[model samples]
Target: SAAELLGDPAAYESMSQAANPYGDGRASHRIAEVLLHHFRGKPRPADWGGHA
Candidate 1:
């Protein structure tokens, strides 16, 4: 895989620029949104962190 990526500059660039599927350092925001919605009856955020 490393050699294949090295041999293809476009592939390497695309992989390097791709968004991380794991997260974007906003786990706290998402968690807080869920907790507030559950406990305080606040409206859930549009993002909803991820899928149900």
Candidate 2:
């Protein structure tokens, strides 16, 4: 759709993709670990940091 909007079929080739700057898409998991329990009554993993 971006390429179509730009009217340049080659535009897609120039697009750049990168990792999510905020986190590794585990925000919901992190929130659940804090506000809710994942496995009903287990402790969170030792390394539960958001991202690198």
Candidate 3:
């Protein structure tokens, strides 16, 4: 089934490289904001996972 998804080279490449169903790993602040504002009903924290 997984190999079948690779049959179309272009589609496979795009799918393989595209964003996953989960949130993007690169946007910690954005993800944190979403989690806080939407899910937790809390304010967006100042750090948002970028701590020293």
Candidate 4:
């Protein structure tokens, strides 16, 4: 059963310390940036556009 599998202390500890094969928190930020870019386009502030 699922509960039995998770109930083992050794298994739980191993799972907790396991590294995420996909990504970490940075993936979440990247996803948000892509969504924002899709909806709002690139952000070019006025300060950055002024160049002589």
TM-scores of the models, in the given order?
0.48, 0.36, 0.31, 0.39
Model 1 ranges off by over 4 Å: 1-16, 47-52
Ranking by lDDT: 1, 3, 4, 2
| The best candidate in terms of lDDT | 1
lDDT of 2: 0.60
Q: How far is candidate 3 from the true structure (C-alpha RMSD, Å)?
A: 8.6
Q: Which is the better candidate, 1 or 3, if ranked by lDDT?
A: 1
Off by over 4 Å in 4: 30-52
Candidate 2 vs candidate 4, lDDT winner? 4
The parts of candidate 3 lying over 4 Å away from their true place are 1-4, 23-52
Q: What is the lDDT of every predicted structure here?
A: 0.81, 0.60, 0.67, 0.61
Clashes of 2: 0
lDDT (tens digit, per residue) of candidate 4 on 1-52: 4685578888777776788766564656666676677788965322322212
TM-score of candidate 4 to 2 decimals: 0.39
The candidate scoring highest on TM-score is: 1
Clashes in predicted model 4 = 0
List runs of model 2 lying over 4 Å from the truth. 4-17, 36-40, 50-52
Q: On a 0 to 1 TM-score scale, where does candidate 2 land against the true structure?
A: 0.36
lDDT of model number 4: 0.61
Looking at model 1, residue 42 earns an lDDT score of: 100
Cα deviation at 37, candidate 1, in Å, is 0.6
C-alpha RMSD of each candidate structure in angstroms = 4.9, 4.8, 8.6, 11.1
